[model samples]
Target: MKLKKGINIIDQHDKFGFYCNGKFGGNFVAETARKPIEDLSKLFEKLRRSKKFLKKRDFYFKHYLGGETPFFKLNNLTKYLGGAQIWCKDVSAINGDAHKAYHATVNALICKESGKKFIAGDTGAGMFGKNLALAAKEMKLSAKIFMGTKDISRQAPNVKFMREAGAEVVPVDSGSKTLVDAVSECMRHYVSNCDTTHLAVGSAIGANIFLKICAWSTSQISRELKRQLIKEFGEIPKLKLINVIGGGSSALGFWNEFIDYDKKHVELIGVEAKYAAPLATNAKVAILHGAAQYCLTDKEGQIAETHSLSAGLDYPGSSPLHGLLKDTKRARYTLASDKEALNAFKLVSKLENLRPSLEPAHAWSECIRIAPKLKKSDVIVVNNCGKGYKDKKIYIENIGYYPE
Candidate 1:
């Protein structure tokens, strides 16, 4: 395939420099040391052409039925912070109130192409599962979403939405009753019925399918970000920071385009839950529970359990691409505690009048604190991953009742 106009070009051996406009420099590491350009291009082409991979979905317009998501301007904060300008990718405008819609829209297309009668997957926060189920139904397929017994309790509202979408919510009562167990069970189901079933993963950290799904889903961020810059300022926005990597898809979406771009000017920082960070503090490169990439592991090489208030970011491992990104210093990974995330969510809601998803809220607050120091004239875009409606219970349980 020919390289697109806006896409960046780089050596297969390089870790970063994969984007169209060189937004992120030397971001993700490339594992293929052999650097056979023809072979690698063929492989990527196979992924691009494979029906099982993905095609575009409808969320581009459906997310904003009325109009494009407004590009939030933070010149006030920019001036206060000295030079940094701030913008937000309003993924909350989507139907499910999260960026999961982007992945779901394409996963449904993949399910249909694979001729799968049933869609099977797992969820912790419920955003991805619900989004996948809705996408499947929209594509005329059946969905079976496996949820942990714990997630069933924590993400009840999302459970209801999945059921309403004609998905069978199977509750796993196994160990932890969290995302890991549910994923193990889902893998079992997939292996048992690989003949007819396809797993629709929400995030890109674990499975190869997830990496592809996320790559396709998150590409929209680049499109929108470019449009926002072109519309607002006469020149392209000088990007200082891009945060959207919780669960890695949204981060991948916007950051992928910048992989080969100018590294000195722009920076890509992925914000994960403070307790569950593969990029921040983890040392080892190992396979995670259901992921095909390198992860943070224990002494026995078992995937280390992650701790986080946001269910979405609680993964023991990150996407292999992310590992590559981290190794190359094309991106910086950071963590935010539950308290910090909750406070960010509250601030965005009060100031922007938008209730962002918990995962992005964590990053948003962190950005708000550091934006003043990063660069005054530079633009920072944070992917507000999802809305906070599904997190109401967790909020009530941890923080307090919503301030009415």
Candidate 2:
């Protein structure tokens, strides 16, 4: 389990830890930050094994991130489809209107506990950056956010929120200048500054420690979903959960709780942007973001550039957790093009009177596509992981109109 120092971070990425071995992820932490980060992993594992029902995260979810979100049955969408029952896991009410806060807040708390003065991390659509900033502020810790320049422009709303919350937003100009670059720079920055910083990875991704921590924190979603399902129907109904796949945090969180159930009982489906799909495309295994995973690679086997109208989903690879799920056939991955997402965004806005962020709109689009094929007793819950407020500009720009 001994890992050598990660090297040539700005160039060669394979020196980061391999995904399979019991090694530190990314091998990316500095000597100073290593113990603290390792302590964090231990802390999360301890709480996870506690019999207190994960009460700490539960408290944060309610008060800090806006209590247990609703599992509202989409009456209009269901009636419109006329096949399966559709439900919306409304995460829009959470802080930053996304599930990023689920892990960000807890990570900031852990930073404070570790006596760190700052929490540093990266963002894609900017929700994670904003959430990290807000969490640090609430914990009275300094925050630094790294975001790719491309994301800064399209996700201005969250960028503004991050700055307004008193966090320094560093624009990454490297590589594609999008999420992948932001993650690289953030982890690199942590290497030099880990004396007082804990890397706050936003999604269920990155090196093994990061992937485990983020996924563990976001698992709060499915925890709530499981409880809400019983309360809603007085028993768990035939269910299929659909969530957008970026780094696969939210989707993993949404699906993990139900994963133990029989596939014939609670099915899980993950939706990815058509052009950015790694798992959905059944991509070949490769290294990305310091770990082994599936990615869309070019003919030369380098990770391919990905395209998605949703800034959050505009990445070439997903978490190894997803790769395992896909390979095991426990979860299914599918694609939805930008046009289909745009259409679903507008259509659902009109039908449900709910404005969905483009990220989750992809998930909704997949739900819209498959609901018509299921039986009437089947229940479909789509993770509306973000609100549309942050996407108003992008939405209007693409469709020339945003629904009122």
Candidate 3:
């Protein structure tokens, strides 16, 4: 692919060095960079004037991207939990059943602008794959999704959705037969098909350039949350923003605007599955999936096998910015075991009539742990990142009954 003007060229080694006006700009990192849109007024003005922006905005609106999702005040659940005004940002209401729909839409837009004909990537629970397939289909581009065999089994519904959306699903059996292996297979595929295909990374975990793009795309979540909070509470209310972290895109999206908000006003909590809690356990930094980050590894630095009831959270490494947040104490990292998550899943479904994917159920477990101790005046906002439809069969098999 020919390099576009003002866009940096990313080599096969994944070294991202930006160049603008014939001068080398330093490598991009989340901590040092400003938020995506510093001035909303200027951004709106530019969007209004640019034909390309207008076209993309039309596409986004048609597909329900860049729009407000359901923000519910969970009064009954809050009463049951006995503390905090609990609010849930229901990303599951989005078209692809997850926040990843926004990511995939933005990725497709980028590829369309670049004149790419094919979009391909790796997925865990298949949420990203389904989203990508939907976007690619809408854009008249072909899609190929690499998924782990284990994830394919657990996420059968999502796999079927991807195929229905015109994506070719390829099962990967390398490594631990999970996300890491899927990523490896996708990278190899990209190497062979780089000219015609654009890799649509599912998370904020990749080369620096890819991470920057993901963070910028997912910033819509925080922007919408801020607007909704003001409308609901008469102002941006002080609250605890709770999210589950696999590759950290959802957590980053939820907390992006609040990163510079008063730390005392907003406490960011990122929960991980107990079996894949690298950040919670302070694991060593290592290179995985083209980025150096906290990874669960053995004595020889090989990626360790991870298990989680939620296929989405069963990853060996996390986004690099998450490690920075943990190191700087900007965000607190915690873990919830399968038992705790499943119990919260059942409790939330019964009390709230919301069947959240097990990924965000980990965040709900953390909320269950901490909400009771907090004052009633306090607020907690949970990102219900995805719906539980794909995991229903797995849940029934594990618990031996349907959740009432």
Per-prediction TM-score, please? 0.83, 0.90, 0.87
Better of 1 and 3 by TM-score: 3
- The local lDDT score (0 to 100) that residue 271 gets in candidate 2 is 93
User: How much lDDT does each candidate structure score?
Assistant: 0.66, 0.82, 0.79
Model 2 segments more than 4 A misplaced = 1-37, 47-55
As for candidate 2, its clashing pairs are none
Judge candidate 3 against the unseen true structure and give its global Cα lDDT, from 0 to 1. Answer: 0.79
- Best model number under lDDT: 2
lDDT of 3 by residue, 1-404 (tens): 12232321221122232222212222333331222212221343354467987677556945555467889889888999898889999877887888888778877876776677998888998999999999899889999999999999989999999999999999999878888899878877876776677877788776555655566666678878998998888987779999999988888888887876666899999999999989999887777766777889998999899989888899988887777667657789999999999898888888997889889999999988999898888899999999998888977977665564
Task: Report the Cα lDDT for residue 83, model 2.
Answer: 85
Model 1 Cα lDDT, one tens digit per residue, 64-95: 22224556775544555464677777767767
* lDDT (10s digit) by residue, model 2, range 1-404: 21123321111123343433422135434476566566766766665667563676677778878788877898999999888999998987676688888888878867876778988998999988999999999989999999999999999999999999999999999878899889889988887877767889888777666787787777778888889999999988999999999988898778767776777898889999999899888788777766667888998888788888888998898887777677667788999999999999988998996899999999999999999999999999999999898899988989999877
Task: State residue 88's C-alpha deviation in candidate 3, in Å.
Answer: 0.6
Q: After superposition, how far is residue 84 of candidate 1 from its true place, in Å?
A: 2.0
How far does residue 214 in candidate 3 sit from its true spot (Å)?
A: 1.7
